[model samples]
Structures are given as C-alpha cells and as structure tokens.
Target: MDPIVEVVALILGFVGWVMVGVALPNRYWKVSTVDGSVITTSTIYENLWMSCATDSTGVHNCREFPSLLALNGYIQASRALMIAAILLGTFGLVGSLVGIKCSKAGGENYILKGRIAGTAGVLFILQGLCTMVSVSWYAFNITQDFFDPFYPGTKYEIGEGLYIGWCSSVLAIAGGVCLACSCKAGTKEKYPLRYHDRGTAYSGAAPSRSAAASTYERNAYV
Candidate 1:
C-alpha cells in the first residue's frame, strides 16, 4: 500500500471521528429563529438530549428532555445514529492501525493487511453514512417546522452542531475512498502483469536447462 495515502486517510478519519464526538453533545442542533424580531424576548435552542433558552439578559438555562419516549421521532433516531457512528469510527480506527502498511500489528502478510485495511475503509464509509443521515434528518425536521406558518410551535433554524456533523460525514467518506483506493492498488503490485491473467507465475524464459537452473539459483539467493 502507498504509505502516504494511508496516513492521509487516517488523519481524515481521525478528524471526522473527533468532529462527530464534538457534535453529539452540542446543545444547539437548532436555534430559535426570530426573523429579525427584536421584540422576541427569549430565544430557545435544542439538541437531541436537551433544550436550552436564553433571555436578553444573557442568562441561559438548559434542561434535559424529561423522557426519551416523549422526544420527537427524528431526535430519537438521530441519537441512535450518532451513537452508532461513533462506535463504527472506533472500530475503524483500531482496524486501520493494525492494517496500515507501516504498522507491525498484523505482521508481514501484506495481502491480509490489505483486506483488513479495506474492511476499515468500509467501516469508515458506514460511519459517514450514519452521521449524514442523522444530521440530514434532524435538519429536515427543523426546516419543515420553520416553513410551516400555521404550525403553532416555536420555529427553529439549523445550528452549528448540524453543520459540524455534515462536515464530519464528508470528511469520513473522502477518507474511506482514499484508503480503499490505496488498498486496491496494492493488489496490482502483488502480482506481475505477465502472470496476472494466467493466475500463476511465469515459469521462466524458454531456454537451456542449465540457464534455467542458474536463474533459479539467483532468484533463490535474492
């Protein structure tokens, strides 16, 4: 595998994983949108787990949702997805460290290492997908509520947490693609093109037995 590409992908995956962790506990998945209404005395914000409000006085108070069952459907699902994403990232990191070409964790069997790295890549991709779906679903609900004039509830706008999650998802997917490509490239070097189609090594040059013996001896020494 290309060591440079492997390292770059690992960096991307690590950053994305950290971003997801940051986003998960963030208090502002959505914020109350006042539409420039200065008269609006208090602004409210919420995330998957809790709600918070701040008055013009700059004092803010937050409270966890009273019950999980009472929370909105999208919020519950987002919570699950984000947790799953974190778990996937953890496994991917472990697998990546073990499988990376420069690492000694998996020994010198490069073909096996390549497979492990590819699996890690797949895990990272799944992590991105889960995070993407969670944030997008949450944002969709916020917009749907905000656009509904007849809806009696307080309207909210997308917040920093959702933006962070989106960015994390993008980084994760990009990293996974890079890692997968690197692992795929390793297979080419594992076998020479002359023998690739034949699924076996070239027997050697068509020549005298003595020449073949000499070639074999040189190969063995090398």
Candidate 2:
C-alpha cells in the first residue's frame, strides 16, 4: 500500500471524527426563524441535547431537554445516529492507526495491514452515512415545518451544526473510499515471496562455478 495514500486517508478520517464530536454538542442545530415575527424579544435555538434563547440584548438562557422520549422523532433518531457515528469513528481511528503502511503497530505483513485499513475505511463510510442521515433528516423536518403555513409550532431554520455534520460526513466518506480501494493491494500477488524450484532458471543462477563443475561419481556396478 502507498504510504502517502494511507497518511492522507488517516488525516481525513481523524478530522472527520473530531468534527462529529464538535457538531454533537453544538447548541444551534436549529434556530427559530424570525421571518414572520413582528416583535422578536428573543431568538430560540436548540440541539439534540438542549434548548437555548438569546434576547435582543444578547443575554442567553439555556435548558436541557427534560425528557428523551418526549422529543420529536427526528431529534431522537439524530441523537442516536450521531452517537453511533462517533463510536464508529473511534473504532475507525484505531483501525487506521494499526493498518497504515507507515505505522509500526501491525508489523511488516502488508496484506493483513491492507485488510485492516480497508475495514477502517468501511467504518468511516458507516460513520459518514450515519451523520449524513441524521443531518439530512433533521433538515428535512425543519424545511417541512418552515414551509407549512398552518403549522402553529415554532418554525426553525437549519443551523450551523447541521452544516458541520454534512461537511464531516462528506470528508469521512471521501476518505473511506480512498482507503477501501487499497484492499486490492496484495490480491494480485500469487505469493509473498518467490520460491526457487530445482529445475527452474533460479537453480542455474544458484550454482557457483566450482559446484557446476563438480559431478557426483556413481559406484561401480557389481
């Protein structure tokens, strides 16, 4: 496997993992849209974990969501998926560290290392998919509510958290694809090391001048 490719893939995966962690605790997954309000005393925002509001004076008030079961369906799913994504990223990070060609952890067995790297790539892809689904589903709900005229509930716009999640997902998937392609690295090789057969060209090359000249004498027949 190419060391450079392994390094690049590892970097992307690590960055993507960090981005997921950042996006998860972010408080602005959704912010109340102020388009129709004539008087806005405060703006409300929320993430999977909590709700917050900032007054016109810039003072902020925040509270955690009291009950997990009471939250909206998309919110719950998003929370679960994001958590799962983080976990996947964690495992992927470990795998990449052990599998990379430049790393000394997995020894000199390149084929095994390549397989591990490919597995890491799969995990990264899974992490990206989870993040992508969570963000997109949340955004879809926001848009659905925003466009509905009769919807009495507070309408919110997609916030920075969602964008961050999307970006993270893209990076993770891209890195995964590159890494996954490396699984084929040692597949075409018939053997890890070549063997010299007795009658092959290698045999001719192995004999020294004296060895080639020497001949075994057969015993005289009775």
Candidate 3:
C-alpha cells in the first residue's frame, strides 16, 4: 500500500475525531428575539421566583431552571469526538499524498498501497457515520431539551453551526475514503509481475528434460 496515502488517511481520521470532540453539547443556544432583546438562558433564569410573581396581565411567570452541568458534559464529549475526527482527516490527507508519491515511483508495492488506502477510507467512513449520529442527536434532542423542557412541544431547527459540523465530517470521511482507495494494495500487485530466477525468465512450465537430467547428475555426484 502507498504509505503516503495511509498517512494522509490517518491524519484525516485524527481531525475528524477532534471536531467531533469539540462542538456538540450546547443546550440553550440563543437566536435573535422578536423584540430585539437578546433572549438567553442567562437572562431568563437569573433570579429566584419565590413569591410566584405575576405580570401586569396576572400571568404567573415560570422561570426555567435548566441543568447546565449535564449539557456541559455532553458538549465536552462531543467536542472531544470532533477533535478525533480532525486528526483522522489529517491522517487521510497524508495517506493520499503518500499513495500519489508511491504511484509515481512505479514500485511493485502499488497494489499493497491501494489496498491500504481503501482500508483507511473505510475507517474514515465509519468515523463519519459516528460523528453524524452524535451531532444529530445533540442538535435535535439534547440541545432542544435544554431550550424547551416541554416534550412534544418543541421542534428544533438546526442552525448553520450544526450544518458546518456535518459538512466537515462529510469532507473528512470523503478524503479518508479517497486516500484508502488510492493506497489499496492488491494481491497481484503485491507479487512480482514477472517471475525470474537469477536473471533467467520463468514461464509457468516444468523444467526442460535435459535441465532436469543435469540436476539429477549433479545431485548424484554430490
């Protein structure tokens, strides 16, 4: 297999993991408010409503007390996974480069290199799948729950940031797969194209009768 391709794929895999490890857990993501007032969890869940205070319209104001620690942990884990992804991506890129270099060298190990590249690509794909699943879950469920505790009452609209995360994961996966393909080392290519012994060409045939006889005589003498 092309060593360069393998290296590149490894690097990409690393990067992919890194990305996944970094940006996953945020429960109360803030968007613009209708009244132009910045609506954030910090603003809403600031004070204690000990007296069950009501507004001018006599509406009981229920302030939210979302758990930040749980969200923080999820986010940290997701971010760590993202970092791993980034590393994987970098590895894949390096592997691809190695594969290209090996191809140019016209070595007998081209098939091996290709096979290696293919393996790396498969790994990259697996990592990407994981990344997608984690990010999707966090964006839809964890983060949504953070914002609105009401079950079946909240619909999460994935923002641009989540989209970017997905895109990066996809890119890393693609690069890794490509590198693996480039470095795949096939069986035939792993072996020599032509079989020869001591500069004598060999055909897929038995030795000539005279040559066999000579070998026998030599053995007999020994």
Model 1 vs. true fold: TM: 0.88
RMSD of each: 7.0, 5.3, 10.0
Question: Candidate 3 lDDT (Cα, whole model)?
Answer: 0.52
Ranking by lDDT: 1, 2, 3
Model 2: lDDT of residue 17:
96
Q: Score each candidate by Cα lDDT.
A: 0.91, 0.90, 0.52
User: Lowest-scoring 10 consecutive residues by lDDT in candidate 3?
Assistant: 42-51
Q: Write the per-residue lDDT of candidate 2 for residues 114-198, one digit (tens) a residue.
A: 8899999999999999999999999999999999999998999999999999999999998887788765554545344444343
lDDT tens readout by residue for model 1, 59-137: 9999999999988788899999999999999999888888889989999998899999989998999999999999999
Highest TM-score: which candidate?
1
What's the TM for model 2?
0.84
Q: Judged by lDDT against the true structure, how good is candidate 2?
A: 0.90
Query: Candidate 3, residues 20-86: lDDT per residue as tens digits?
Result: 5443332223222223235433221111111122443555554444554544555556555655555
lDDT of 2 at 93: 94
**Which residue pairs collide, candidate 1?**
none
TM-score of each model, paired residue for residue: 0.88, 0.84, 0.47
The lowest-lDDT stretch of 10 consecutive residues in candidate 2 is 213-222
The clash numbers for all candidates, in the given order, read 0, 0, 82
